[model samples]
Target: MRPALHAEEDVLLVVDPQPTFMALCPDELPVPGAEAVIPVINRILAGPIARAVVTQDWHHPRHLSFASQHPGKRPLETVDLPYGTQVLWPDHGVRATPGAAIHPALDQAKVVMILRKGFRQAIDSYSGFRENDRQTGTGLAEWLRAVGARRLFIAGITRPYCVDWTAEDAAAARFETWVVEDACARLGPDDALDASRARLEAQGIRFTTADTLHGENA
Candidate 1:
């Protein structure tokens, strides 16, 4: 049986639903079908989800994670950073740019907070609760806990990266975590997404679709 979400205990987490990340954009890191998730997420917000939080990947121009900043490093090429292995990306989500802005299609009015990350120009932030260094905290956990948001319904773009990291952290933070599967898109192959799903399941993070959310009688 599927679990019921109580708005008092559960808050929707919309991750990186930006135009720059959509396949239609073609310039920034485009996750195929990313744009399609917005309406599903909006439907959830307008119905079962009364409270929400949104994340934006607000990067800086020439950010260290960008391949252009590192000579001879191509996008998606792996390299060692001071913190850990890093994935190089094309310049994206530059601060003050449209790519950095949340997609206007999203139901932003329902969101209680907007968390902007990856602005430091050195560290990358995929997890909404923590930076890539995994040491620096973003205070998302604290805010959620303080507000009594006990379960998290995470949705939005690039399921294998930002959404994946946020779900892992939410589980670690002891929130009953659920990933809205259809409300997410991916940048990589099916096997990569499969691997990420397996790991998240191992950590006890459950997955559901946006359809399930709206179909519920509750």
Candidate 2:
């Protein structure tokens, strides 16, 4: 039998489930079928697992990571920043905009933390625990440790980026991490997804489906 998830032993990390990435926002960085993850995540939230944290991108207007901030740059283009090769993105997650808010459909009743990140104009944040530079910390790992959480189940919008990075960081921080595949939306193709899976698996991150998590605890 699969190991059952316990409330005190396990925690949920919902990464960047904002309207900015949903199909409704075609201009701002929409991920295909991103809205679908809400229900899958809601099911997980409604499950036996109790403690949870949700991450928000929360970027500022004209943030440096945005293509609009750099003249002649386009979305998905690569430019070398002080940190490393940075992928320019369409203006997204601007604070106080409707797109930056967490999707209204997501259940937050069990959420204990609504962690907002990427608000700085100079840096782009992908992981909940750290900025893109990888040196500056967000203190999420410390918060989890303080709360005595050991097993981490991550889910949310835009897999292979936010979800991938968060899970990898969680694993590196010594948490038993699992990524709920079906609960994550992606902007890439199957091959790209496969590549991310391999990369994450190599880092000791495991994968599961939302159905499996729900059924196991049911």
Candidate 3:
């Protein structure tokens, strides 16, 4: 049987469910089945969870993470930054753009906090907990701790990157973390998703489907 969530101790974390990501076309940086996961996430939000937070990738137009900022570089290519390997991406999540807004289908009213990340023009933030530079934090950990969140229930777009990084960091911070498998989509190759799952599992992060969370198969 699957474990049940303790409403007082667990918090729901929705990672980067913005229109910039959810509405991506096949030719763009589309996460396979990204749109289909929204309903699942909404259902989870409607559950008895006591607290919820949302992460937004609010990047600047000319952020270093954008391939366009670097001449001769293309999206999906990698460059070594002072921090580490940085993956170049098509310009996205520019502040004040319609795509940067949360998806219309999501119930934003349920969220208690909205953490905007990657606002720095020179740095990229993939994890809700920290910037890609690894030295800078978004203060999510401190907030979760203050609210007595002992476990984290995470769901959102592009599992291999954002979701994966957030889960890993949450686990490292000693919070029991679980990724709602059906509530996330993968942006990269299939192997990337598999590898992320393996890495998270090895780090002691749990996985459950939306059905299991809803007690449908429990």
Looking at model 1, residue 192 earns an lDDT score of: 91
Global Cα lDDT for candidate 1: 0.88
What TM-score does candidate 3 get on C-alpha atoms? 0.94
lDDT per residue as tens, model 2, 108-177: 8999988999987898999998899998889999989898899999999778889998998899889999
Query: By descending lDDT, how would the candidates be arranged?
Result: 2, 1, 3
Candidate 3 has an lDDT of 0.85
Per-model C-alpha lDDT, please?
0.88, 0.89, 0.85
Give candidate 3 regions above 4 Å deviation.
24-28, 216-218
Worst lDDT run of 10 residues, candidate 3, spans 22-31
Please provide TM-scores, in order, for all candidate models, with all chains considered together: 0.96, 0.97, 0.94
RMSD of each: 1.2, 1.2, 2.1
Candidate 1 Cα deviation (angstroms), residue 55:
0.6
Which pairs in model 3 have colliding backbones? none
TM-score of structure candidate 2: 0.97
lDDT digits (tens) for residues 1-218 of candidate 3 = 36667767878899988777754533335565788888998887777666779999899889899999889999989988889999999888888787888888887666888999999999899999989988799999999899788998899977889999999999988999999998987777788789889999999998998777766321
